[model samples]
Target: MAKEKKYESELLITRIFSAPRELVWKAWTEPERVMRWWGPKYFTSPICKIDFRVGGSYHFCMQSPEGEDFWSTGVYLEIIPLEKIVCTDSFADENGNVVPATYYDMEEDFPLELELTITFEDHNGNTKMVLQHIGIPEGITQELTKQGWNESFDKLAEILE
Candidate 1:
């Protein structure tokens, strides 16, 4: 009998924004604010539906510059105002039904479900935000995901300024 190998990885990114912790928190909890910086550069979030409470869920649609739409949905597992948020993340369809990453033609090794933890701290009147994403497969996909996240954060920084 052959044993199956298990594969799992995580991505961690920390950034300091020149904005108050409350403001940064709102950027995540408020649908309108989220639309301003949800995707990478030149990507517009056409839809953002957020129910900001534990056990609540959010659905978002990020449209690429070339008109491709990528949808994602997540359920809030925990929430602490101006402090932290823990959620279950997953790829989804336009209607917000949970789907595998391969549904979008991504690598087959991508996990069907993922976890995300976001923490915010006060840093000299600014906000220090840390994002921990779990269950991603390591390699090019992870690198691309990191680039996308950094681009999204850059957009968030511009708005905070």
Candidate 2:
């Protein structure tokens, strides 16, 4: 009999922005603006392919400071224009095909994929953005992912400004 491994992990981030919900939504839907704040600081994302409707896909390449580039692609499960978006994200090769095996952040067993749900709400004149990440591998990897997302949102706010 084979032993069954247990998997557990989740991340949630809530942010209140001083911008309207519509503008915030546009930043996410528009490719040019999204590229400006899609990844971590010092990492520039120059390549972006966005299809804002349901069942569409968003793909991009993030270039690190040392000229190393990483490719990430995701398929939009749901998109409620100005309200919410749900997608499944994964690390991919140059042809956008998911690699059969990969090491992430030095964790050989870490899951290279995650499901993300992003919600935007209007709070008076301010916008509240809630991001929920599920299915990430456990331990330090999850924590690192949360921090990375927070930093990305911080960058998003700056771009919105």
Candidate 3:
């Protein structure tokens, strides 16, 4: 029997956007701007509610091209103005209660909640952001999540341009 390869439990991505750090921070904190680029390619964020402060919560609804809605809710754990944000992320119902990924018909191994840390820095008049998502499932789901984030970043870049 072939042994399964162990994978890291976290996903990390770093990208530089051709915008100021403050602009990138606003893009994340403002509901209207987040609605513009919160999901993968072809996925639209039709509803976004943000309470951007420590201990506050946010809810977002991403609709697929086929009209399936994916809801996510998270509570802010830490917030550093124009610099960093740490939150707890999870699948959620329209009412913003946390749910297991299986609630969305996804893999059972997906954690009920995940930690997300994002840090922003100024890079030659641009913004360099680092994203750390912990507790992603240790297999294909992680890859898919990374791809989704990349696609969303692509959309964000286009909007910034």
Candidate 4:
């Protein structure tokens, strides 16, 4: 008998939005819509470009309250319209070139590439979205990522309203 492999994931976040699943999906895949709510509180995405197909990429800059800019880029690995999205996310420059997590000068080691999977399901007339992020290193705390997601989702909800 073959032994089963237990897959370990670092973070999981779930949000139930008061909107249709398709609308929620649009908010994630459309650049115009994403600009409205892609960052956390006090952070604005001044630049966003999304080519939302398999192997396509999305890049954006999240501006801090103090006017500092941080960039993130992702390449889509799978996309199921209105249902699921899987992508590899990484810190990057304005040109979308990969950057090491050490650039952030954090104490812990944050993985340069992290796989994020999101699924959208219909909850009656609303939408239930689940986001799972894998490959976070042990030295890095999950709270930081969780807080960022929670804050970003709060912004997303406002746009969905």
lDDT of each: 0.90, 0.79, 0.91, 0.84
* Candidates sorted on lDDT, descending: 3, 1, 4, 2
TM-score of model 1 (CA atoms): 0.94
Query: Model 2 reaches what TM-score against the true structure?
Result: 0.88
Off by over 4 Å in 4: 1-8, 138-140
What lDDT score goes with residue 88 in model 2?
A: 75
Q: After superposition, how far is residue 139 of candidate 3 from its true place, in Å?
A: 1.4
Per-residue CA lDDT of model 3 for 34-76, tens digit only, reads: 9999999999999999999899999999999999999999999
TM-score to native of every candidate shown? 0.94, 0.88, 0.94, 0.90
lDDT: the better of candidates 2 and 4: 4
Error of 1 at 149 (Å): 0.6
RMSD of candidates 1 onward, in order: 2.8, 3.0, 4.2, 4.0
The order by descending TM-score is 1, 3, 4, 2
lDDT of 4 by residue, 1-161 (tens): 10111123468899999999989999998888888887788898899989888999999888989998889998999998889999988889888998976666654356677888999999978999999988654433577778888999999998899
